[model samples]
Target: MNLNPDQVSNYVTKYADVLVDYSLKLVSAFIILFVGIYAIRLINRIITKVMVQRNLDPTLTKFLSDILIWALRILLFVTFISKLGIETSSFVAILGAMGLAVGLSLQGSLSNFAGGMLIIVFKPFKVGDTIEAQGVIATVSEIQIFVTKMITGNNQTVFVPNGSLSNGTIINYSMQGERKADLTFSISYDSDIKKAKEVLLEVLTKNPKVLKKPAPEVFVKNLTAASIDFAVRPWATNANYGSVVSDTLENCKVALDEAGISIQPYTIQK
Candidate 1:
């Protein structure tokens, strides 16, 4: 069947109109999408700058800014799809399902992240502070988003998960201005307690690093199976802890030996 020329022209014109309508809709959608994304990014940058000016923690500032930007961009995308006559309820539902699945898989990591946030906000221990936490003793090197980095006395770096750090007991040695050096020495029972105390006091007095405010304590602590234990508790600066400890031990031994007191060693019978 041969078609008339006028009929063919009318069909072409109708098809062109449909194509132009669709093209306009697509162009509108793309423009809105690009503008929305740019706005979100601009808002994120402004928020980050404001936070930085307010002296907020860098990690928290970045995290919150990124979250805000993503939330806004997602909202804009949903609105753009709705403008294009697409149903968004199903899309939102799918996103919710995917988010739940991902969250469940990352529960532990999320917990750790939350713990780290708590630690930062509460200011339990800052970097460079010596702390004993989670059965590990070390100086805090860095406090990250999910873990706390520590440098041990032996110069080894250790990373403690924030979840465990937040839940466990944290002993911050650097919090206090001074720390006590608890040193115990064993002497023969025959040794004179009064004379021993005097010698120990002399050792502490000779040491310039020992703090004078809290007087050094020297007393008989206990009577063990082999000898009598004497406790010497002295206050010292944190930086001089090891040095003072080593010096105290060496000087105490010398002082005791000079006073004719002998260290009682436990004897094992074969």
Candidate 2:
């Protein structure tokens, strides 16, 4: 194409104006990017401090802070792109769609994650706690985001999903710092009930593992055609629960035999 000198100058000026405009926008965008990054870091630090002040779980605090930081960075990127005169609404829409798709695909995982958050926040149980949930009685070994690892009495490890665990019933044996051992002892109907009660109470009281504040109790629970059942309850620290129950049962049998009270095996009558 052929043009006059004046026309060429006018075209060059027009192109220069466009270049300057774009350059200015690019500079502004970069400035915003750097400033936004600094702001994001500052916000993350503030949030972390707040979580620490609240004594939140370290893992959860870090996870939340990272999530927030990433989200802020994304927003800042969108802003920077918009400032550079690039369309961002479509990009944002695409991102939203992708997030939705991922969330739907990970529904169960998200639920578990939320449940874990609740567990960490509310603290239903802690590591080394003995808990009974979902028919599994085990000591919690580790508490993670999706599942809780537990070790059973037989040294077997089990992972319970936090989703169901948080929703279901949790029996924390160590929560109250004590546990009550419920025992049933059977005696021949001909045996003296008063003597049996005394013997069982004596056995419990003599056990050093049993707590004295609650003061072990023995009461007649039921009378059957075969024998009388005595309900023996002893309160003890979680550490001593097993020993207290076992020792009390052995001592009660011995004391009953010495007192001339006969104990009989309980049989189910059809």
Candidate 3:
């Protein structure tokens, strides 16, 4: 139909006003987003600085900071979208569902993180402690949010997930100041048990690493079909445990051999 010019002008004006309003809202939304992002970054930096000053656990600090940043950014984005006059209830509901999905999908990771928190709070172990956990023995190098780093005696780096560590048994060898070294050696059935004990005593006395407080002693641990086994226990500082054991055993062997004591090697029977 051939419409009136005035009616056509009115329609154009109405459409132009709606476009201009939307354009203004869009510009405002952009401005808010940029400022909100900047503010989130600034707040995260401040939180990090505070955590550092307070000497908080590095893993937890970083994790919490990241969560705070993401949460704030999400809120800012939702607000920005709301400025454009769009419904947010469904958006929020979908976001909630996504969060639930993420939580379920990342259950293992979340468990590790929670385990780390428990370890940190309960003081079960700490960095630099020699620990045997989950069938692995190593010195703890770092404690992270989801995993604990360790260096074995062989100098191998191992990463243990905190979930298992927290739930499993942890033998902390370094927690105590001192430990006992148990050395057992076999002697011929005819060997003089008295003389062998004397030799072990000498070995313990000569070693500087052996602590004199607890003192060292030697006794017959067992008598098998072939030979008698002597148990030599020497107390030493945890720092000297490995070396002390090595040196003590070598000294005992040499001492017994020099004393003309018959040393019998234990033979496994078929």
Question: Cα-based RMSD of the predictions, in order?
Answer: 4.9, 4.2, 4.4
Mind giving the per-residue lDDT tens digits that candidate 2 earns over 91-128?
A: 88998899999999999999998888899888899888
| Model 3: pairs clashing at backbone N, Cα or C within 3 Å | none
Mind sharing the TM-score for model 2?
Answer: 0.76
- Candidate 1, 1-270: lDDT as tens digits: 999999999999999999888788878988999999888888888999999999986667766786798789889989899777789999999999999999999999888998998888887887788998888899998888889999998999999999889988989999886888888888987889889989998999899988887888889888888788888888898898778888888899999999999876422111
Better of 2 and 3 by lDDT: 2
lDDT of 3 by residue, 149-171 (tens): 99998999999999999999999
Better of 1 and 3 by lDDT: 3
* TM-score versus the correct structure, for each prediction: 0.73, 0.76, 0.73
Q: Residue 206's C-alpha lDDT in candidate 3?
A: 96
For model 2, the stretches where C-alpha displacement exceeds 4 angstroms are 1-42, 57-63, 80-85, 117-123, 266-270
Task: Identify the runs in model 1 with alpha carbons over 4 angstroms from their true place.
Answer: 1-88, 265-270
Best by TM-score: 2
lDDT of each candidate versus the true structure? 0.86, 0.89, 0.88
How would you order the candidates by lDDT, starting with the best? 2, 3, 1
**Ten residues in sequence with the least summed lDDT for candidate 1:** 261-270
